[model samples]
Target: MTMIVRDFRPADAEAVAAARRSAFPYLVTTAETVTWEVAGAPAERQYRLLVAEVDGQVVGSSEIGVFHESEEPGLAFANTSVRTDTLGRGVGSALVTAAEEWLAGLGAAKIFAWTVEAPHAVTFAERRGYRRGRSSRVQRLDLTTAALPPLDPHGLPDGVELRTAADFLNDPRPLYEADVECTEDEPDDVPAGRLPYDQWITLTWEHPSLDRELTTVAVVDGTVAAYSVAHTDGRGSYWSGMTGTLRAFRGRGLAKLAKNDALHRARAAGCREAFTGNDGDNQPMLAINKWFGYEPAVTEWRYVRELAA
Candidate 1:
């Protein structure tokens, strides 16, 4: 079967989401979330979605764009996912070629991609001049079967209170501030700069997938100290968007407190499974997830390639 790679269309949202889910079962994506992501992307991101077709059927998908939030300029990304059953048909290669050409046209100096830890996946990336970088583990928890630790509001440190993200709807600047502080310390192969408040408000706070009511925030003395952002598909799957505590509040167990509250709320809301990811070196966050009975499900490695100017 001949393979063709082209820009994604609105009608392909479902197929794209399906392909993504097939490639990464731990993710929670729907047609609506995919559509919203493609349409609501900021101009700076220059986000573009591509799909690979065989006999008119979408067998692979890719998300290509510049790392607009990175502190370094000319950093780009092209994450390609081909249905497991459709692998080795040149679909992934075609998609990567198209994505690289498009990003090179945009003057990207370097491009990054992620691939599963399997040998075939790593070989595909290396053959295309992509070098392996950092690795991250995808974790899953059986919310229905896992023995979740109980939440004790009174046991929290004095002056610390757990609140939902919805509590700051009228004024979310504090949450934004906390997010900025925590993200600065996150482990990543590419450095992510501080996210501007305006952009955060539009891309994160107003995003369709973010479940504000389930997101837990730890407030200390009326100040946001740590938070656990939650995203749900309105079904039974819950994903952790971000869970972090301010530098000053790191050792106080506030991050765990916030995530525990968030996960408990998610389970109480009928969520059956929970998913999260962390860099291999992010031991603190990994330990926290382990405490919640999350088991490592899959692993992915970052790959990078330099683009000719």
Candidate 2:
């Protein structure tokens, strides 16, 4: 059983997405998102999608790219996903090896990855010279059964208005500005700086999975004070990609309001399951998710390895 690792072709999107879902069922993945990631990544990121094939069938895949948006240089990441049924077939190792060689050739100083907190997964990463770091919680909410908060649009705070991402199609600069402010406050190992408007539009706002109708925003005096970005697979699965509020809007419960509205909209739109990730240290957001009846599905730890010069 020879395993061959090679660059990903557009035709491999479905297999790659299936492998990813098999490895981490809690996360939402679709072939369309996989194709968009590979085709729409910024050039400076040096993004490469690697696939592992056994007898012409894809069994694993890895998303490898530089942290081009981070102010810090030489930081890269390579996340490998192998089908659960093929766990011990060395497919993961082969994908990681190929990703490292390519990233090292590009002068990457450090590589980061996320692995499930299970014992076998932890050991696999450790044996590959990766060290454990921060962890995040993957949570799931059953949209069909959860008791979602009532959406009373007219009950918002004084002068605060509720809007959907679709309302900003004419001018999304406000949303981009809000995203920049909110992203800066997110807890992460890498410090990501502001992305150019054009890049944000290409990579985020215009993404195929982004459900503008379900993305709720809180506006205060005509300003985007908070928002919850929604992503859906068109298969009854929804993901809360990001939820944040501007600094000035803190303590107003705007983030909670926005996310609540988004979740409700998702349920009404035929989505059955919802998912979101929260950093272990982010108590506020974690509490918000808990309020929505989301249960802990899994924990994934960030792993890092210094590349040998």
Candidate 3:
């Protein structure tokens, strides 16, 4: 079987989505979401999507782009996913090579990729000059049977109330502000400080996979203090898109309240599986997941490599 890599064409939506699902079962991917992602990419992101084919079948894919939202320039990302059955056929390497050169041309000073915790993944990165870094656990909860702990019933404390993302249909800047605050404090050591409301509107709220109804937000004094944006594929699978509280609202349990509301809505809507990922260093979020009865499903070690100057 001859394996080759190339750019994704419009007609390859179903095949590309299928390949991604086969390679990363933990994700919630749909043809429409994939198409929207490719078409709606911002110019500053330097985004380019690619696919690897073997005997005319797409066996792998890579979403390569700069983290334009990061405070620093030239930091890029190139995540490659290959169907498990098609591994060892050189598809991953080919995709990586193409992605690296493309990103380098965009003036990317450093490139980061995620490799599963398995030995082959480590070997692959090390041999390619990428060094390992902090890891994150991908967790799953069988919602049908998992028992959740008693939520803090302070009823939001004073003038705070909990609502779904749909409530922000008319104005999403509140959610954007909450997101910016929480993201700046997320586990990744790399600095990310972009908070332009217009940019947030374009990149997040307008995302195709976002299930606004399943997303929950905590509003206090007419301000979005925290939120948990949920992602769904119009399927039974659910993913925690982002769960964060504004710095001023951290210890008030707003994050828990928002996520609990999301999970409740998800379960009511027949979602069977729930998934979330957190950096190993983020003990607070890990504890929160534990309270929800989630367990480790998989792990991915972060890797970074510098190109020759």
| Candidate with the greatest TM-score versus the true structure | 2
Clashing pairs in 2: none
Give candidate 1 regions above 4 Å deviation: 153-155
Clashes of each: 0, 0, 0
Q: How well does candidate 1 score on lDDT at residue 131?
A: 90
Best of the two (1, 2) by lDDT = 2
Q: What is the TM-score of each candidate against the true structure?
A: 0.96, 0.97, 0.94
Model 3 worst lDDT run, 10 consecutive residues: 148-157
Residue 170 alpha-carbon offset, candidate 3, angstroms: 0.7
Residue 143 of model 1 has an lDDT of 94
Residues 189-264 of candidate 2 have per-residue lDDT tens digits of 9988889999999988989989999999999998899999999988898999999999998999999889999998
Against the hidden true structure, what lDDT does model 3 obtain?
0.85
Q: Is candidate 2 or candidate 3 better by lDDT?
A: 2
In Å, residue 186's CA in model 1 sits off its true spot by 0.7
lDDT of 3 at 173: 76
Error of model 1, residue 214, in angstroms: 1.0
Q: Highest lDDT: give the candidate number.
A: 2
- Displacement of residue 27 (Cα, Å) in model 1 is 1.3
Give the clash total for candidate 3: 0
